[model samples]
Target: MKAAILLIGTELLNGAMIDTNSIYIAEQLNKYGIEIEYKIMVRDVIEEMEKAFAFAKKNVDLIITTGGLGPTDDDITKAAIAKFLKKKLVVDEKEKKELVKKYKDRKIEKKSNFKEIEKPEGAISFKNDVGMAPAVYINGIVAFPGFPNELKNMFPKFLKFYAKENNLKSKIYIKDIITCGIGESILEKRVKDIFTEDNIFYEFLVKDYGTLIRLQTKIENKKKVEKIVEKLYNKIADFIIGEDEERVETNIFKYLMAQKKPLTISTAESCTGGMIASKLVDVSGISASFKEGIVCYSNEAKIKRLKVKKETLLAHGAVSEEVAKEMVEGLKTDVAIATTGIAGPGGGTIEKPVGLVYIAVRVGESVEIIRKEFKGERNKIRQRTTLFALYSLLKMLSKRYDI
Candidate 1:
């Protein structure tokens, strides 16, 4: 059965609060074979909430909403749902008893938020173990509190109840083939004919390091999906980096950490401003292999820290292949990566233009530098360079022969 997720919060629409409830609920529902076809976010406004309910009811078999259940004046989710369903808002006596006992047990003062703990009439309600608000599953919509902690605590009980009622055991069939050192257009042209069948849903996405082929099939047969993945792998064995290619930075760090022999890596940054190093640090236990990261933004830093000579800088400028290579040469590690570029909106000249990036990869004794005139603004260029540097490092560690 299909489902729809509705997140009701004015703060979410105004960007003051991030709505993670939808993501969490969607993932949980997928475990029960409930596919979510629509994800919507509506403000705390009653009109918008009613409209969201109407749309979701028309679109899917199940509707789930988070937020608007808190003890505040803006907490109007039950009221909205009641209006939408033409029902009356009634106090839940059981939930009220629990709340009253909790207040007495804890010796806490009764507040305005406590009065808001009511459910819509004619609905199945689940007790909230961690909070005052009750989880109500009514008319295909499950409503939870706005707070993340309370929602997480209450969602599991709702999941079990819903699964028992629906009798669902879903199997997800998905694979992402990540290819490095290949352009998206070329990769698409090479493998376009492989997915001509009507049953497969495939997408070609361009990532910084390479292209990603996300293939999803509707059929849940494991053997059938495995055969398809195996066929596709055989066709693109030269480029496919497995599903971990989707999570490039983490995968790179994880692979490096799992090596039989420990390896050290160093970074020399220019236009990327230590973005590659920062990304590597984001992964847990990166210190196991990550040795050092240097942000040599200035020419003097390159000369002093990375031992880049002043002569090379004057001859080829900071954003050049020579400088990138020299920067790597100065670093001693199992793998050394370097970046030099002009990530800017105004640094273009007749000879050198903005978005000109030079990335260097040094694997053991071998070193290679790639130069590309990338497109986009400052932030985009830096981000692309950072991802490319990580991609290059992944190649050096995993596909040593390719480098």
Candidate 2:
């Protein structure tokens, strides 16, 4: 099944507010095997909204609209939708009584906002658990408020209802792996064959650290879909590190925390700065697994704080594998991850060019260092380096514990 989303707000068109509803709606629909083909944002104008409704009805099987359902003057979505469908505006007696009961303590003048309960004729209203504006369900258009909290509560129930009514079929299984020293384009080419199947869908999202590829297969026959996922899993087993809902940092933290291991991690960063530390702290329960993180950006700081030798800095400069190894060893943690390189718009020589990063992981008695060169903007390089550090740590922990 196919759907189109219509977002109504002048604020969204002027870039005053982000249209995040579309993403939430699309993801929800995808879970039910509904594909969202087009999304359009329009101002609170009657003609434009009616035109959008007409266009959606002709093209897609389902139309979901958000915003413009309040009691204010600009809240004209209900009127427009009713006009487009050639229906009369009728007040719902039960909804009006409920609205009045909610504001019985207040004066009648203050209860004016409750006028929103007067929905169009023949429309079924879905109660909003979080807000006052009730969502309206027509034949195809499902209209809800623009507020995120309200939409989140109402949209799931709406989707569940639609799925049961339409008998849509959807199945999702995700396989994820952490890989270092590889780019997305290269990874896509290597795993291209797995993406080519009659009932399979593929998406690759690149984060600061690396690329995450999700393989989704939908088949009426559940057994066939499971078999295809198994076959694809075997083909990409080597590059795959983690699976559905398990992130690289989460997996590493779980492994360390389960072992009751006391670990202190630190960073000797030149390019990545404190991004690595920020990411590590983002995971909940990280305090149990992580001890400390140090950001040594300057040469003096690296020499004084991380105990990197001055001679090494003078000889190999800052972006070298040797320096990265020394930074990891200098930290007082059971496991230390270090990154040193040039994330550049400037600061590049013939010998040391831009996008050159060296990462080191130290655990117990063994230390490993790997060098990579990434091509992107400054933030991109920093993000890639951080991801690489996490990948390296996961790899080391897996090897040591035989996980």
Candidate 3:
């Protein structure tokens, strides 16, 4: 089924608040075979809400609205929806009693307090356990609250009810193949033949580390999609890291932990700061293999903490390949990564411009140092350098230890 999302709030329209409801709703609807055709954002104006409703109803079978459900005068979603459906607004007595008793006990009773319990005539109201305002369903419109926590808690009930009334078979099947150490254009060229197939579609989401290839096909073409995925694996299996929600860091953590005698890993970071270590710690239970993380941002810290030679720093500077190699080799661990770079809007010379990074990865006796000149702001350069450092270590580990 096709759907439309009408987001109502002045805060969202004026960029005072981000509309995260649409993202969550769209993802959930896609899982249930609903195609979201239009996403309309309107302020707290009744005329605008009605117009959005008219536009959505003409094109979609289902319309979901979020926001402007409260006790204040500006909370007009319930009224606007009632007007659009040409229905009378009525107070829900049970909800009104709940609100009245709670407010009366707190000595804060007002006429506006009952507004939270109002709904369109004959519309089905779903109680919100987390908030005061309740959600309503009428004429194929499901009105939910603006509060993210309340909406997230209440959406599952609506989904369960909707599933009972509609056929919820998924329309599309999606597969994600995440690849590291390979750019999108190169990866696309390697598997360009798969694009000629009529039953499937491919999309590439480029990331700082690598690319995420999203492959989709109609539900009926499931078997054919598997064959195509196998074909892609055969073509670019070496570059592929993990699939779906897995990232390079997670893959590395898993590989490190799965070894017979799990290898301990450490990091000595310069331009990337502690980002490489921070990402490693994000994975749960990674402490089993993750040993230490040191930030050697200054030349003295590099020399004192990681034993990077002062002579090497004076000869080739702190951001050079020589210092990066020494930093990685000095780490007391089975596997180590070191990053040094001139990630900057400043601190760059003619020879070593901004985004000039040297990453060193050492696994046992083997050490590899690579120099890359990336293009971006300081944070972007640091982010890319962190990913590259991790990817370098992952590559070496996979090749030497076959993890």
| Candidate lDDT values, in order | 0.80, 0.78, 0.87
Q: Report model 1's TM-score to 2 decimal places.
A: 0.71
Stretches of model 2 off by over 4 angstroms after superposition: 8-28, 43-54, 57-61, 65-158, 171-180, 183-216, 220-238, 262-268
TM-scores, one per candidate: 0.71, 0.70, 0.73
Ranking by TM-score: 3, 1, 2
Which is better, 1 or 2, measured by lDDT?
1
Q: Give the TM-score of candidate 3.
A: 0.73
Candidate 3: which pairs clash?
none
**Candidate with best lDDT:** 3
Query: lDDT score of model 2?
Result: 0.78
Candidate no. 2 TM-score = 0.70
Clashing pairs in 1: none
Candidate 3 whole-model C-alpha lDDT, 0 to 1: 0.87
